[model samples]
Structure formats: C-alpha cells, structure tokens
Target: MPVDQETTARDGDTPDDLGSVQYAQTAVVPMDPAHLERHRVVAHQKAHPASWAFDVLRTQVLQKMDESGWRTLAVTSPSVESGKTVVAINLAISIAQQTNRTALLVDFDLRRPSVARSLGLNRPKSLNDFLDGHASLAEALVNPGIERFVVLPTNRPVNSASELLSSAKVGKLIKDLRERYSDRIVIFDLPPVLAADDVMSVLPRIDCVLMVVGSGVSTQTEVEEAMNRLSKANMLGVILNKDESPTQNAYY
Candidate 1:
C-alpha cells in the first residue's frame, strides 16, 4: 500500500487538534528532535538521509505483512548492540506516519527495555508495571508526539523474563493487542535471539519476526544460529545495520 495522503494533510495541524477527537483515549507525549538524535531514532527527522532507509523498510515490511495477513511483528537481533531497537523504533515511527494505519510499538525486551529511553519518555507506569499487575494496559500506553502511533514501554528489567514472556498473561496480552483493532499494527521489540531464551520464548506468540544484524559485529555462525532459532516463526526478513560502505551509509 502507498503512503496515505491524509498523513501529509494533517501534518500542519496542532497535536491537540489532531489527536483530540480520534486519539483522546491515548496519552500524548511530545518528543524532542535532539533527544531522538542522541538515540539514533531518525524516522521523524524526515530531512535526514537515514530517515529514507526506515521509510523504505516500512513500505516493504508492510507490503509483506499485508500479503501474509499478519498484524503483529517482533523485531529482534542475533546479539546485543545490533541496532535492533533503533530499527524497531524508526520502523514503527515510519509506519505511524502513514495515515491508514495505527502503529503500536511494545518494548518486550524485558531484561533490557530501552524503547522509552530511545524516545526520551520518562513514563512511570509502563509494560513492566502492567505485567507486574501494578498498572493497566491503558495506563501503560503513550503516544510520543506522532499521529497514529502509540507505545507500550517497559520502565526497567524484569526478573525471570523468559518465564514471564512465555506465560499465559503475555499470550493474552499479545492476543488483546492484535485483536483490539483491525487497522492497528503492533510491533514488539524483543531481546536478542542468541543472548537469551527470551526471544525464543516469545517468538511463537507473535505473527512475524524481523532480525537485525550489525555489520562485522555478528559472525556468520551467529547469524546462522539465530536464523535456525527463528525458523519456526514467519520470518519477515533480516536487516543489515551499521554498514559503512561508501555506497551504503548505515542501515540497509
């Protein structure tokens, strides 16, 4: 599907006026461009060259998801520091920028949740609190100054993350998030596939998976191993990140 024209039309409207009617139920949080730059989140920075990469990624991902009838996507990497979180954040932002669909990003990397930090959000109640029974899902949802975008961030690390991820509660949470709205695309930022069993535990619950690999950081063996682990799920594709070739800038 092509990018929606309504997104461009609504770009000039104030956040309050844009979100007041349709997204009144969502908590809106303003995002600072400088803060986003620090975290390498460039999707909202449309003028940046890096932003186009994410826009292209978003289009391709959405086309495959649409063809496969998939709604929930889990973004993970073979190991840490592979720019998977950055990819997840940017891809979600790009998706939300499209007017036809609402994008909901969930920080499911419970052991090292960083989605809130990447977006410069200091939310007290998040996915952590919701999973611990301290807060409701509604209380955990936040809109980070983007139309058609919502985030369910995790504030801190959780104990027994693997167990929690594989638990019935998480299953129900994923089901609810997916079924709540037909026009919504839910993206989950999962832990590294080779770092822990967290990704494996949650893989079966999501509709599709995307693997991000950093150039020169992950070995061929590691990538193969990660792919082996992800073979059971509907593999969306792998993202090659931090590529510094003369022709390619960073992510591909």
Candidate 2:
C-alpha cells in the first residue's frame, strides 16, 4: 500500500560489512555461470541483457516493502508455470546486489520445491531437514556464491503442505526469520493461489505477497477467483509473464 523511492540496480554494490561466504554459518555452494543464461535465472547482466525485468521488479517491490516496514514477501501465481519461482530467485539476487540490505529466498512451496534446482544447488541441506527436525535452521540455509544472498531450499516435496504451513513450528519459524535481522528481506516462493490452500494457510504469517499471472495460462475467471481469495492480503502488483517476446514482457 505504501512506497519508497526507487534505487539503482548496482549489481555488485553489496555492503562491505555484509561479510563473505567463507565466514558465514550457512553452507556456501557454487552456482553454474550458465544457469542465468540458460533461461532459468533472470539476474540482469551483460550476458542476458533482457533479464533487466527482474531488476525493475525488485526495485518496485522493495520500495513498497521498505515503506510499509515489511520484512517478508510471498511470491505466488494464479496457477502453475507462471514463473513465480524464477521471479522469486531473481528478485532475491537483485535485491542482494544493493548496498544496504541482504536477501534470503525461502522455498516455502513444500509441495513442489524448485529453488534449489533452479539455482543449480545440488541436493543441499534444506527446509525438508529443518521440518523433519533432522537439522537446524542454519544447516538448512545455503549461499549460492552471491555476496548477500542466502536460500532455504526444500530438497523434496512434503506431504500435507497446507497443514504443515499452518503448524506452530512454522509459525515460530516465520517469526524467527522476521526478527533475526534488521536489514534482511525474506522472500518465500509459494504455491499457486488457486491450486491449493497453502497460500492462504501461510499468507497471514507473511508481510505481503506478489502475484504472478502467466499470459494465456489462466482464464479470466481463474484470475478473478484467485484475486478474491487474496482480498485481505497486502497485495503488491501482479506480474504478466510467459510472453513470447522478451522485449514485451510486462512487469506491472
């Protein structure tokens, strides 16, 4: 509902005090340089010039979050294949590129987790471990060679995702993540709003949400239904994705 001033992308402007991965408690992993150029990642750069869409999206989304004092953001779609996960990853990377804040991308889509795969993180310890009580939160976190970027990836799909999202354990997890750091933006890559009750289950625990609607993927009725479901959410704008022409990709 509120907005802050826009800022430059400045891809490598992460703060000097943010510290390096070598000293971080989270496990540091290497992301293939080819992943971004492979079309899965959209971190705008010289190699993938058209990926600047994520930078603009990040600026706008972060502006609203900063103004509203929101620390967590949920990224979801009306239905499947709307590029929500990709958007989440790119936004996290784009935000981490800034000088003031750090970004943590969490794969909260327990049903069909893809953040690890999308980032080329091979079987890293993840949310599955944390949820099963086999690992601590720090053990589940992964740094994909990005200075201020961290990820809590889900290694596999979990049963009863909606119920899991509503549990007390998850509630405490969200609270801890929110209060852990003063200048961290935690982004959750969630399931489609219309596909399941997972979004509604966890929406209350999050600060705000960004909807991704794929072009020609969902009907007008479906979009309307999904929006009505989010009537109470702190709705950030919707993204028009899956356009055939990259230049015509719509961010608003």
Q: Of the candidates shown, which would achieve the greatest lDDT relative to the real structure? A: 1
What lDDT tens digits, residue by residue, belong to model 1 across residues 112-139? 9999998999987898887787866666
Can you give the TM-score per candidate against the true fold?
Answer: 0.87, 0.87
Q: Could you tell me which 10 consecutive residues in candidate 2 have the lowest summed lDDT?
A: 1-10
Q: Can you list the residue pairs that collide in candidate 2?
A: none
List per-prediction Cα lDDT, in the order shown: 0.82, 0.79
Cand. 1 Cα-lDDT:
0.82
What tens digits encode model 2's per-residue C-alpha lDDT throughout 66-106?
89999999999999988888788888888888547878899
Runs in model 1 lying further than 4 Å from the true structure = 1-24, 244-252
Model 1, TM vs. native: 0.87
Q: What value does the lDDT take at residue 83 in candidate 1?
A: 83
